[model samples]
Target: MPNGGSRPIFILSEDTERERGRDAQRSNIQAAKAIGNAVSSTLGPKGMDKMLVDSMGDVVITNDGVTILDEMDVDHPAAKMIIEVAETQEDEVGDGTTTAVIMAAELLEEAEELLERGIHPTVIASGFSKAASKSEEFLEAMAEEISIDDEEMLTRVATTSMTGKRVEANVDVLADLAFRAVKQVAEESDGYSIDLDNVKVETREGGSVNDSSLIDGMLVDEDRDHPGMPRRVEDAKIALLNVAMEIKETETDSEISVTSPDALQKFKDYEEGELREMVDKVKEAGANVVLSQKDIDDIAQHFLAKKDIFAISSMSSSDIEKLARATGGTVVTSLDDISSGDLGKAGLVEERKISGEEMTFIENCENPKAVSVLIRGGTEHIVEEAERSLIDAMSVVSRSIESGKTVAGGGASEIELAMKVADFSDSVSGKEALAVRAFADAIESIPRILAENAGMDPIDTIVELRSKHEGNGKTWGIDAYSGEVTDMLDGGIIEPLPIKTQAVSSASEAAVMVLRIDDVIAAKGEEGGEGPPAGGPGGAPGGMPGGMSGGM
Candidate 1:
């Protein structure tokens, strides 16, 4: 109002939808809360799975937080922000995606209460930031330094991740395999660095989940391309190629016209010679097994098979790299570069029928730095879920090894941190203390939901947990399977400290980011399309908010 009251000046386009003040904050908080509530039930070992069917009716059945959020066809911008929290947690720690999303939702929920009580969003954000920072210090103090030699504890970390994954009867075996694969590929340079990508996973739907096995080397999906080739190569010498074995075609568009039949016969003979030369090059390199990124012509395959060379074509570039790491071989780009020195070695390169499909297994490389895990289950959905479970298990194990720190799981860490944070909040003065205390309560929601998901009474569980930790029971927490409060450490429930810290930090950041927003503007998309594609940050996130107070 420049003078008293004039026409409301509109800086945005006429069709934009805008929300301001409490209304905007409320909308964002509600959307975030909805997302959290959606995944809260899938929290603990006894937690149930969600079966999400997309618009195309593609079904995904699992409790993996990031996967669920990823598969969700959400349109709300605020809800999408919550998904970012889960994505960050997953990308950083590989586990704790659900915990992170749930924490952010609870934080916003607590902030909503503060907002109603007239606390500024900035004050709440500041308090939450302080709480998150202090919690990190507390968590570090609580963590016990672990080493790779702590195999039993590492196994426990993996087992804790897979507990509620609808996994097979042999969880112990699966956990062992997960950590084993991590150990195999675990490398140390400046510090402990584990390339999880080096740990290859293949899922099969024939055998039971217990039948899953970890291989010492890489697994190629395609078997030897020709039947005449040797099915097994002992002391195998592998030649990895990125070039095609067929005759090279000209780059330009041209046509060949032969006036005589002899000319065409000469052309065919030259092509045959070129293909034979390609096979001869591989044979000259003394490569018993051939894996290529491009196709091998039928004539070349026939010649290679006649030479008793095991040949597989059309492999992904990733497979080629994995084979290089597994077999200690070099990838030769050109046929001329195919030499004996360039070949990789494996104790056995064999093709075996797995679930009615023949696949190649390159195993027993000397001190291999890469490996594969063949995950098996009786059904397709089970196999998919097991793959997800194993990913979580392997991720926790690797994070544990790299950080060399461990914490008691089963809500033990969350309860103790909440108490500490609550005490810290009381030391603070002013309205900010309320937001700090709110953060403490929000973190406690983790343990509360864990209990709830386990079919136990959340109030009783929290009460018992608080009582246990009141003295010096930092490791005391609920056991999801037994519905009993006990020492999580002694019960073989543990997690990497990084996972917990990352979840808390990311959740707080997301909550603060969402809370600080008091205005939302969704402008029309550029070129006058549907909405907000070319629009600035003020533009709609995906599409305009429904029935906002504006032209659109």
Candidate 2:
């Protein structure tokens, strides 16, 4: 309220923070471009790794774009949107996360130039939308259908995904494992479906990465529960029990008073009797091997060992589920429900010590629906990185089988798409045509970055690529290994079609969203009164015009 008798006058506080017009647009575009530049160097086979140290001083070293962006503590809204572009690309295609983010940044950078030429944001956004849809159409037309049974091509796709990672020495071996694993778990219905969960990857640090091998059945991280039990069971009839061997308590808390010595004796006798009955039920079901999700009582263990049965207790629920799928068994919830049909069959169930740790291997099922891959590396970090690489490989193979198509990699697909998009720009007219042309130029950044990362002159490499592509050599791409422009298809550089298609759609959408923002309003700080000055949360360093002043 103003002075006493005057009518209440409404007014905005002086501390209110807001930025409109060019100021807001510049701040957002700068933040997004900064994030893109941070990851542009890590784009290809010759790309270098990023070593990120968090607040806890923990270090993560990887060239994987998604990992780098995910680990960064980005604060700016526009920067966060760029991270979403990477995440979406990863979630949909499992590879090309970096490419998606880089593409979006370049698109926004180009849009900024159009903005300076007085083109409206809506005009630029609409042009980008058209370019994105056209690129997808070009990608589908350019893609080559491949049979899921084509193991050689699948291996190439997997290897291409892992080429820039830390596990370069064993990429072939790992790629083979990944291809086999995905194929082993793939199912064909109306279309192909792959449950990657069925393909488990377990890592151990001791032997070299070449030691990694795929198992036809599931692997349990546990060993035999009792030493007296058989170390190995042949022609194993396995029972999966969720019920505990020990006596279960009442649903509600109740007291069982034992005032005399005879009462205690009776209690012990009752528990022993119940355990014996449980063991008898399992044996009657002809289950020579037992895997229990709950603990096994000492008395129960002795009885099972005396019967010469192989038994392990406290198995994880996930392991138990995998065992059921791999061995064609049903998880019985109660001992009394044990039946022959509930037992799983395995050629052999054995306990082996690998790297000084005991693990149970259930092998040689008739037709396993689930499998495992044991990844062995020389060190812990290597094993971890190998697992990441294998996951990427597995995901790419799965996507390829699902989509049933692939495209030449090594920047070949991008260059082809760029040329097609550039040709498309000719059909459109006015300011929108310039925006479409900028989009075509943005797509070329992939090949440009690939050449730059390989230490070659980007200009000469792109020129050669453009010439080759323009001459109808659609598969010609920069060979990062030798820095020579050659046939990516003949060189065995390939990737799943979904990766490129997803990158185009996701990156363009994100770029248009950022371009559409023309105003920003920040609430005042609790202690500082005003939140941030007009341009953004902070002033640009050295007073550089249109610099990213916000902490992103």
Candidate 3:
């Protein structure tokens, strides 16, 4: 239709949508910024919480960035990219999600300014990448190396992660519990590495946060399979099972013709004998407690109770793994070859009822490699938040131990890195230098937002930070409690080194990826439903981007 009055041909379907050039950039940037701002106020210790309500009337109240993003239905592709940043940060270090998303948003914000000045998207992306690399270098140089033995430092790092959550009132207790649980499961190898899976959390309501305690072994949320079984077993020799205790049924259908009454009696006795033999094998293996990954038959339960064995059915695989580690036992898949050595040992196995729920406790294990932290609270919401807070705390603590390094928290590390990155940008010559400088400005927004959320003057905070960090005091950060600039290290505000570096690395990468786009091509579904493919309006190829020199 362009050269003259000619018939137009379509490369895509009639419902396809496309936004090209500057309009596409604006649309993507606006969407990313909107999501960034949505989670911005949940940044630091003074940040506010969000109450998310679902269609079924289920509500989740949390300030956790990943949780909030996961709950929201983000339709735009650009916004979903921001969510990925938060998810990656959470998965990598379990904290600093808000910082990562906010940085990505601010980078786009700065790139918009450059876009208005006629700067190319590629140039902005290049500058941001360079800036991000410089920031990581600066942070690595600024970090302090510590070992797993630095308990107080680890405690401070744990407390920092749970600062603004609902369980802050009992943070000290929870922090200590998290650290100890991680420490108990920490094993020394080529170097000190902790498998976070070893530290399990069990949440139950109707108790104060102070009631939270660390169990020496794994806690399973199931009672004994039958009431007649012993409530507690001392010096428990447990058999971890992957197979069921039920008698097997033939896969193919068969007809059993009982020609006489004695023949039917013989069949019943044979079935009872098979059930007795299964329980006899467990007793022969010296297993006083039985935990199975599959179901236990009613007849099998009677035999186990008659033998005074405490057993649980339908145990999850994760719990079974933890139990093996805790009890120093191996899981037996088949009953045909289980020996006394195949059993696991625990000093005591008991079934206790707490808050109307029965839970089996396999405690008093010797040299246990796995541990549990029971999280208790006054209500269900508080318990949920407390569990989330504990997870964040435990994750940070484990990260600190594994990395053997940490940084001063409370925005000190961010402002210092920003200062260093901005100065590094001076040596680069070109429009890209502006983007690099923009990266510095983008991350500095962290401290500004921190001050803002804490009810302080952001401008004053940034100015003072720049002054103090000019030639000295890199560890100085805004003290929300006192509303003044103070040394974070001296104030015991610390964070794992990986969290900060991962945040900057991921945020900048996501920003660069978002910046490199000049066109958005979308296609509608067969039913013409709205989704990421519906980001832009349906249109023709005639709306091609304007920056190209050749015809399409």
lDDT of 1 by residue, 410-429 (tens): 99999999999999998988
Off by over 4 Å in 1: 1-8, 251-263, 523-552
TM-score of every model versus the real structure: 0.92, 0.93, 0.94
Candidate 2 lDDT over 1-552, as tens digits, reads 676988877565666566678877887888888888889989999999989889998888899999999998765667788899999998888999999999999999999999999999999999999999999999999988887889999999999999978999899999999998888888889988988889878888898999999888888888898999999999999999998998887999898899999999999999999999999999999999999999999999999999999999998898899899899999999888789999999999999999999998999887788999999999877888899899999999999889989999989999899989999999998889999999999999999999999999999998898899889899899899897999998998999999999999999999999898887766565654334533343445211224544323
Residue pairs with backbone atoms closer than 3 Å in model 3 (clashes) = none
lDDT (C-alpha) at residue 114 in model 1: 96
Candidate 2 local distance difference test against the native = 0.89
Task: After superposing candidate 3 on the true structure, give the runs of residues whose Cα lies further than 4 Å from its correct spot.
Answer: 1-5, 525-552
lDDT at 427 for candidate 1? 92
lDDT of each: 0.89, 0.89, 0.88
Which is the winner by TM-score between candidate 1 and candidate 3? 3
